[model samples]
Target: MIENIPLLVTNISYGVTFIITVGFGLAVYLKSSRKTAHIMFLFLSLAIGIFQICHVFGINVVDGESSRSIFTGSLSVIFVICFTIHWVLAVLEKDSEKIKTIVGFYTVAVGLVVFYLINPSAFLLNSVPKLYLPNYYEAGNYYWLMFVFFTVGALYAFYTLAHAYRIADPAHKNKLRYFMAAIAIGFPLGSTAFFLALNINIDPIYSTLFSIYIIPLAYGTLRYDVMDIKVVTKKAVSYALIIAGIGFFIAGINWADTLIQSVYTWVPIWAIPLTSSILAVFIGGFVWEKMRDIDILKYEFVTVVTHKFRTPLTRIKWASEMLKKLIPVESADQSRLAVDEIDNANGLLVELTDMLVSLRQVDDINYLYSFEESDMCKIVEKAARNMNKHILDKKIDFSLVCADNIPSVMLDARRMQFALQIVIENAVIYTPEEGRVSVSVTQENGKVVVSIIDTGIGISKEDIDHIFTKFFRSKEAKTTDTEGMGIGLFMAHQIIERHDGDMSVSSDGIGHGSMFKIEVPKA
Candidate 1:
């Protein structure tokens, strides 16, 4: 009704472009890449989108009652100013906060224009909607304030883009040159339509129609992997397909009713349930792609478990051979030497076995802890005895001190001992040669406390943040000669947490040593 048949196609194109602008802009903003870049892009997209929406608005927005087309004319002028400023800021990588301030100013300016349009009788800006072709065609207010906002937006954008282009990176300059060219050509051509709409009695539809030239630049922005619009289209198609299928079935049922109204008048009611069931079945079946691949975890699992089994089994074999050679030994010193060596090798085998056993435990989300009513002193002594060979070999000065009032605790004996062994082994592995590693247990404020303090190459600030994270090692430890599979601390954290105990780290950065304080409930 507003123009030739071409205007109808142009209106649809505007709808698509506006939707794309909003969707792409939102993805970039939420993604963790560049907060400044994505946020500026969002502002630019929103401004352009507001203008596009107004260009397609009809008198029916007010139910054909309002005389003035406030949306069509006013929003168009404001869109030019806001869109240009945002586009320039986005291109230049301007300070995000400063650009946001400009956005607030532009929004306030545009709102004033729209406010004056509806209340021309009581304001500085006048509202006037002129009819060029009777009820079929109409044009809205020619407010001067509205045009001022538009000119300001255009000039701001021009300056923004020009300043940004001069400082762009070499890689960015080449890829962005086309988008720059598009802006150079598109904004001027688009702005010309706004100026013409103000003074002349020309068809206003061509203004929106000419704005489609900016799509080339939009495509460039979206295709650069910065915008994740592909994911949106994937979901959108699924919704459309489902709706189309239901619509077809409904149409078929209505046809059946009319064809046999006398014979089967109740067919439409039955079609409702059938349509719902079809939709339910389709959606339930379509979510397989959204499920995680799981292959990455599976690959890491095989690698970890394989190394865990091999290390301990090799130690056990060598330990067994040493015990055989020790039978009917030559000297008193040789026999003592053989026994200590055998203890060291067997200790490694037990640790390796515990390490393997932990892999299976980790897969079980909930395993009841085999809590035994145990003496606090005995638990500490058993752990110390199990780790004696490691202490002597690493020359770590280990000690245990239990308070007189330290209550007996309900603990899983083997698991708790295994937990202590892991922390001790790690401390020995990392501590500088001859640097002391001490294990002490005591009761404090009605809680069992186990402290393992080591003068080791300490954790860095960044490493401590993710030290308990799976398969992660401190950068210093990774670079050092320390041989670790990176699973000991993770398993220890899980075991401690399962027992309602807590573990924490205290480090003075790099060369400064670390301390682990473990606190669990005492029975």
Candidate 2:
């Protein structure tokens, strides 16, 4: 039994690694099976899983049979590299014909390596028990060539990822960062096994720790929009933890029975099943809670969408009826009035559509942004100009002041304009007619700041905290603007955040007016 300790430990490590990689791969594939990148990710995971499982058997089998298992595990490395390169290219949106050609050439090289691997004599000399490992193999004449192939493939994949990260937009850059981090941690550590294969005396403990990569990979998946999956909630994380805990608990009991049968004899066998049943109950409750939360979110989303779209749709229908009545007989003024009403209704529909699109994009990993150095003053002026009609219609006392020689900031101009327009338009809409509305641009503390102050129905203290939440309307806002869908501010906030900027609002209370400030770092 004491002699079996190393084999047991090694099996446990490889077994856990196999489960994690395959589990993540399946999750991603189930979420989006059609995506090329996701498919490649699954293949990579399977390759790793195969490599780990092969090692588990290779280390436990008799020395005479170990050579085949180790050789198969070594062969899996080629697939790992192939899948990694394809996955990286797909994720980075570099899947062009030229890239395919390059990948094909790499595949040819991998094929040659496989040809060499098929004849065990070419890649493996023999297997012998070594320091900690149950079976460690010595390298043959061509083993160095396999290592070179693996090294070159890894370097190329890393290079591709790094180069793409440098040029990727903010959102894509964030996703790539997670992938790069995982590679940085896992690949090099796992490569330590190769040193042992070459007859070096180095311990292969780092190879067992390769599973540590899942930490960052899992975190990136849950915390960010990765592989087109939205951010998972804490409840989801709790569910995963509970499941993993149960698995570990059961495995622990079995391992204890095997390793310490004399001590485990006192423990009742029924106790294990009872504890597992309790855990199952806990999981069920947790899953129910998550389901309830999802249901509530869906209901709220539908309510907002339907409530917001109904008004413009009704108006459009009414205008069409009026247009039909005014056909071919009335004065030009009447016909023009109907056409204008239809046009206004259409404009409202377009605005609503744009808002919905922005809402959808806010949490998307693939949202594209084009950043360039831009003038804060010009962007502010443009937004104000766009809201000119609203200002005139409300007859609000509007003023604009811009500081000269303001430093340019790097931002997506169109998105910045949209964000500013939302604030200015809200100021115009919420403030009573003849109330004051002011826009100003200045630089402060290495950042360009845009401020919009208005004598509007000011935000109450209770509502201020939730102002940027999607579909959340303050009591005063609901009373003042029944048509508001409560998405503009949320969209604006997301845009500013993506630009490495922040937005803040201050209000004295419900009738004291409010001020909104946006700050972006200077280019």
Highest-scoring model, lDDT: 2
lDDT of 1 by residue, 1-523 (tens): 5564555665566666555555545544433223445555555556665666554554223333332343444354465455556555654545464657566866677677567656653222222343331111222353555556655656666565556668864434554666667666666566544443354665554455344544555455544432234654444344434433454455555556556656777666656557656765665465433432343465468667767777866777677677767665555565666665676567656665665655545444463668987775676677677666667777776666766767778888777777777777678778876788777778887788988888889987656655665567766888764577676777777778667677777788787778888888888
Cα lDDT, all candidates: 0.60, 0.73
- Inter-residue clash pairs, candidate 1: 81-153
1-523: candidate 2 lDDT, tens digit per residue: 3776766777777766666676666566544454677788778777776677667667655664555556567577777778778877776657663486457847766776667757767777667777776677677777777778777777887888899889874535666788788888788888888898887877776687775675555445433333223433333344444555665576565556555546668777666666666766786788778877986786578557766786667778687777767675456655655565565546545555655655545544676678999898998998788666667778899999999889999988977888898899899989999999999999999999999999989987767766776667888899999999887887788789779788988898899899999999999
RMSD of every prediction: 14.8, 12.5
Model 1, poorest ten-residue lDDT window? 130-139
Tell me the TM-score of each prediction against the true structure: 0.45, 0.52
Candidate 1 ranges with C-alpha deviation above 4 Å: 1-267, 282-366
The weakest ten consecutive residues by lDDT in model 2 span 224-233
